[model samples]
Target: MSLPYTTWKIGEVEHKLRLTTRQAVAVEEKLGVNLLKVFMPRQDEDFPLPPLKVMLVVIHGALQKFEHGVTLDDVYDMHDDYVDAGGDQTSLLTDVIIPLFENSGFMPRQKETTDDQATLTTVK
Candidate 1:
């Protein structure tokens, strides 16, 4: 069966970045963390967000399908460059990666909570 894919844009071209079931499972096994939870953290979770290295590893794993000829070493180098270039890793995940994953139905839509909604409380 075909795996779902997210869209990643390079320059003017949009590429389909897909993660197979095996790939996803392997990432979780190797990293011992769930990418989705890290990608979208909840206020109630006990653990802190996964480390930056872990997140990069997950990103490299997910990009394997579309980024042929690119080794993990290369991805790591690029990741460093990305950070050095004032790129925020969280922004990459939220702005670039999450949108792609959402488009492919790999992740559900995250509800946007506003200040008013967050402030709602019970007085009883």
Candidate 2:
């Protein structure tokens, strides 16, 4: 199932988001496949450590975006996957994943707290 918009909350803060105009057009052009990330510029990552942690955060954020929500158990499951894969648990989530999402038009809502998750009702 897919939601046009997905509301993500952090503590008392909430983020209401939908695909941006550009993103919408891109999605339409792709015919429904999520724009995937193939390469990352952060080659400086501690290969033996950082990539795994970063991958976890990316997965977590992806679940939130696509699934519209996720529970602690979900995070735990991801964390387990990381551990099982022999990844380091000390990597920085923001440093690892946020840049890519931001560059791709996925961003946290400006207000960070609003029960409003609506897609672009009208494309620009």
Candidate 3:
């Protein structure tokens, strides 16, 4: 079966990011951290941001399926150019990382509810 993936544009090139079971295992082994925990939600205000190296490694792993011959250095360079073009970490998180995992079936997609639905829930 084909794994789900999402597309991210760095500069003029569009790269496909996918996280297969094998690739996810590889990434976890390389980082020595369970990806499920790494991607977990936290409530603490002081919760630490994911390390830059971890982000790069995940990005590299995701890129391996479609971006043959790509390396960690290449991902770093793309990230540098992305920052130079005014992309920030927040944007990267929302645009690339979140969607990458969500679309890859690693994270659950948040459901949207209307005001009436919210009111019904509150009134229950």
The predictions' CA RMSDs to the true structure, in order, are 7.6, 15.9, 4.4
Per-candidate Cα lDDT values, in order, are: 0.64, 0.44, 0.81
Tens-digit lDDT track of model 3 for 71-95: 8999999889888878877677778
Model 1 worst lDDT window (10 residues): 1-10
**Residue 73, model 2: Cα distance from true site in angstroms:** 1.7
Stretches of candidate 1 off by over 4 Å are: 1-4, 7-16, 39-49, 109-124
Top TM-score hit: 3
TM-score per prediction, in order, is 0.59, 0.29, 0.77
Error of 2 at 117 (Å): 40
Per-residue lDDT tens digits for candidate 1, residues 4-107, read 66654444445456666776787778877665666555688664555677766666777777776666786677666666766676666666566655644567
Candidate 3 residue-wise lDDT at 4: 68
Candidate 3, residue 105: Cα displacement in angstroms equals 1.5
Q: Deviation in angstroms for 79 in model 3?
A: 0.7
Clashing residue pairs for model 3: none
Which residue pairs show backbone clashes in model 2? Answer: 14-112, 14-113
